[model samples]
Target chain A: MAALSWLEWNPTSFNINNPWTWSPGSDKKVCFVTTGATAPFTALIESVLKPSSIEALRNQGYTHLLIQYGTAKDVFSSCAGAAQCNTRKDSRREALTIDGIDFFPEGLKTQFKLVQQSKGLVISHAGSGSILEALRYQVPLLVVPNTGLLDNHQEELAVAMERSNYLVRGDVKDLAPAIQKSEDFKDKMTQFPPITSGGHRETKSFADIMDETMGFLD
Target chain B: MPSPPPLSALYSLSFLLALLTTLLVAASLRLLAILPTTHTSAPLAAARRKHPHATRLLIVLGSGGHTHEMLYLLRALDPAKYTHRTYVVGAGDAFSAQRAVEFEREVEGRERERARARGDGDGDGDIEKRKPKTEMETETQAQRDQPTPPRTLRTGPEAYNIATIPRARHIHQPLLTTPLTALSTLLYSFPPLLSSPPLLPAQPPQTPYEAAAADLPDLILTNGPATGVLVVLAALVLKFFDVRGAQSRGMCKTVYVESFARVRTLSLSGRCLVWVVDRFVVQWEELEGRGGRAEFWGVLV
Candidate 1:
């Protein structure tokens, strides 16, 4: 009945650098983290999750931090500047740098081990692909819908996920409360079914028009 | 001749007079039928008065009789909003474009006078008179005094500077004259000949707009489906009647207002209207949907 069992159905390991990465920790609590150039999640993580707020949560004995860095553009370039600033600020949360690995690679057993050692939390931009990955791993998600791009699509997705009781939708203005409620949020993630479509149905539906227009016209 | 005041002659005279009166009535009705009844005369005159200085306006001429309606609409527009830089394309004689150029020249002259008045600071000497050694004047002097250097001068017309003449240049070229459409020029020029009184006179065509308004059709044909039908009908009628001087009139303009109206009406999923109240944000999806529609019809701020 547990949502974590769904990960076994599709046993595809994920690349750590991807916006979605989840693994079982030593405490057996699933943790995942996402950081991409997507405005909503990035804004939620960087702007909303203030260092002071993170430290306050850290004081409550939360140790692991799964950080997703720039999936929207070139990850290294986008996050390198911000990573330097975070280091200068001496933020309390540990930064796990993941870049380049899109999906789970062959020789990443040690990385999984490290992930299992810390009972970290998963954070993700409201990309349906990333959300599906997180759900497959049965990792509780802290969803930050990117309002800047995708217009209202991400907001709709995030609200739907929250309603399904699979994730907690974090507001940009108050990410601390969402983070503090992460334990309760993990309890809530168990209720929803795994996402089946992966957000390609609408695009597939529109693809038929392409063949009729372009193939015939060209 | 020995004239007799007979009853038969008197009866014939009265009958002829009655027939003449009926003929006059029929002729008037025919004239009225041919003339467009949708004449916004007062509105057009008001628009012209309001924008008397507007000599240039952007025009989109399509293939139908829409151009006629467009001109009517243009005339309806407060002329002050446009400089009347009119460009007519599609299927009509080049008369309107020619006339537009003349109108532009007149409007430009008026504009120059207005500009001169504004530039003449506080009733002082004219700005042109004040700026003695202007760039143009210096260039003119240099050109006038400079010797013609004989080394490989360009074979085309020589450039000259004349301060007395206006600096503005108004150029008009047939749209169909381009290399791609040059072959079709003959076909395009055929429509004007069939329309009521040729739109322009056969003199050194001094721009079509310079031709008397009475000579031009009341409408301008645009490139649209409906107007295209009208043009075909008018052409056929003219040919059947062997009429030489009539022209069709209709004009049209495409605007972006329709798209705005569409957005307001369609409220699909994944969209909710959000409103800000003081510092708090509230999401009222239903109200937002309705508001979006309302905003379309509301006057643009």
Candidate 2:
């Protein structure tokens, strides 16, 4: 077997006070949000941009809010204006820069890295792809399922993942509570791609399954 | 004998119905025998030793979410073992195809780094002849076209190829025309399933690698995709007829992984293929045995 170069970030060992970490604000705390890539969860985008959610982020001492809004540019722009207006009026809240991205074809690698470096949070739609990618960065994740879709599987997946402590499930109608939970959830969240389950059942990787299916001795 | 009452009148309606029922029953029995039961993870070392030269693996990449999970699932894919990789993508899915190439390059790059770390002297001449050519190549043209430094490891362009098949159903396509499109997708699936294209065009495979590349894949891996369902069906058809010794030679063994998003219920494609594929794996514990065969191995992606 050849050695693999997968970069794994352990949140437990990650230091939040690393001064060398790159960010606009030296001590910035960021909260990144990703709506679904293809369909674009309008409700999630709208919910995250609501002033309440923004206030929750501010309460957590977050310095930046970045949203991957997908195709909901109109919805994002409309809600973002009012949310920014409310934030600007509050003198007590420190400067929180809000940003939006329509889409990133190559994925959110840069955005996730930014959040990881800042010891920030990721709020994402409950699509498996986004959740899987975000969790790999070892950031606190809050997953919101698009309830409008007919299939309830996304909701089920979020529930199961949350139960396992992999993420916190957020509601599309209100994301503030989940956002508030992110502060404490950061330290206790379970690892992504868990190495084992309950200690009794043997776990096999997808690679192992492939070799076994092919009858490969190794 | 007046052609036995013109043949149409010879058999009664009930008699014809009986014959049809008998055929259907026989087919059901055959299907039950062909479809694998819950497969144990223990490797069949004896079977593997019989065909030790080369192994070909076919991977089906679907739309965005499916493609994303498929790549992650194959992150640990070993090129040295599965010498030949044929990636099947739906027509017009350039994203998936591009990702496949990127994944291959990433693997090659990783192995090259390992060689450098091991203090194997890195030079064009030294790397070129590092390992004996795994495949017997008679084509001087292909050898010239090969770009990646060879001797480092068994990976890069020569080890893998990408194949494209027509989409089973396009979004917004009318339901009335779906079956027709699906039939076409099923028909197109056979060529890739039979064998990957020869490494170089218009040439028969000369080396062991090329021979395996042009032969039926040892395994077919798929997750949730409409096209995947059609491809699996095509493989089943080939096995049903024992085409080119597909069944006898232990080829076209399929393993379907239910999407990680599917925690409690199977997707439409998962439900469709659950009964037929060789192995059905799910990520969540709750869905471990839904179809009486779904194996849970924790979260793969």
Candidate 3:
């Protein structure tokens, strides 16, 4: 196979007017929240838990409300039935919920793309990963730790990020205000380096990585 | 008949037990279905490359994170070689679909302009190639009025197909239902590969080399998310049937990439799929060989 050029944007496969260039803090377009891999997110699936919290967020003017739920994916397989409780019938906006609680929001691409495309706010558990990803994208964030989890370490991570003023840490009980405060943090996200899953060297270009991966095929 | 324990009832009971044993024996014998198709990692991949046709790659785009990482890998893939590609996500994962649509739109936009440029550059050749297929497909679908869009250069065959399969498990579902849900997911992910022949496209290419787009998945690439597990499993099951042609020639090769998030451990899907997947690549060097069949492939996010 010939070496494939990642930069060879054959015009046929490239989008000319990329929408991801939206200015930061432009709008609370998408409020993306996740509780990590396990689902149902404690009170999230049961009793239509936190309907008011979601409402508070909606009231905060997020048009595309994308929330990732844990454990309780079946209940809201489609966004139309998210929260089991009636999501307000607003023709103007949409609420999309994905079950990735145990690995939920697992829509790795869209989540990032959404973050990139709009002033999407990320509300997630305070895992270093969740925090780093949101920050790397320069999205404003809110971190809520699940103390019920085996790792109480997220508490420390949240506290530190909170101290940095990079994000707001909130309890489920106070989700609305926390989301509102995320505005204060979005500007601070530029302070950190882009999250690097690879080692400290210069980041590998898509071309180089493509060659190496395709080499495995050869 | 109830007056005494009928001797005939005892005989009938024994007969039922004997029939049950026979069924169990036959079921065990059917396990032999797996032997013919099972493949070792290295040879299977070798066999795939050995084939002349363009490789078909089914990339299972797990929700959110997996979708992003997989797209990165997908963009890196050689479209010239992997002619036919399927981007599948879990059922009800509109977000994954939304992302895929976004990617496809970009690709389509790119195609639209390139087709125009190609029309300007090699107008006659482009039209001559697309004319027959467009006409035939339009006739087949009975849409004569719609002008044929300039076909994306098949580089090999059909460009891309996107699909969705049911998820293995839902949040907070009962444990007893898990087995059934998983089976349905497996059913959804594959099975079609069994029914459909290699998809060569509308044009009757003179050679399989020209027919690259018409192939079934020669390779399956998955990162994580439970839905991916079904795709990998479906490949294995399809291979077991060795369902004729290139598929029977060998099973589809699968490459399971551990998410970049896993510095020390594998994700659940990664862990579950590791043993079965043909080539398991990890981002963190430290995880190399930590899980059997996995290798460190440097950072690939």
Best by DockQ: 2
DockQ measured for candidate 1: 0.01
Q: Tell me, by lDDT, which candidate is best.
A: 2
lDDT (Cα, tens digit) per residue for candidate 1, span A1-218? 22123224323444434343444432332234455422324454454335654554454455434343433335433554454456446555554233322222122233334443454456677765455445544556677766666445567657755765778887766677787777677565653333223443222111122112112221
Q: Could you arrange the candidates by lDDT from highest to lowest?
A: 2, 3, 1
Candidate 2: residue B13 Cα off by (Å): 7.1
Please write out the lDDT profile of model 2 over residues B1-301, one tens digit for every residue: 4454556654889778989999999888877767775554344332655234677999999987899899999998887678889999999888799899999999888777656533353534544455435452324336546663444266888889999999999878999999999999999999999988786799988888889899999889999899999999999999887899888888999999999888777889999998888888999888888778788887888
The candidate 3 chain B region of ten consecutive residues with least summed lDDT is B43-52
TM-score of 3: 0.51
Local error of candidate 1 at A86, Å?
Answer: 7.6
lDDT by residue for model 2 over A1-218, one digit each (tens)? 00011123233332333432465646878788898766888898889888888888888888888887866789988988888888889888676777777665567787898889888889998888888899888888999988899946788888889999999998888888988887899889888878754756888899988877776664
Candidate 1: TM-score, chain B only: 0.22
Model 1, B147-179: lDDT tens per residue? Answer: 632112111111100001110111244444443
Question: Please, what is the whole-model Cα lDDT of each candidate in the order they appear?
Answer: 0.37, 0.82, 0.58
What TM-score does candidate 2 reach? 0.84
Local lDDT at A206 for model 1? 15
Chain A TM-score per model, please list them: 0.53, 0.85, 0.60
| Candidate 2 docking classification | acceptable
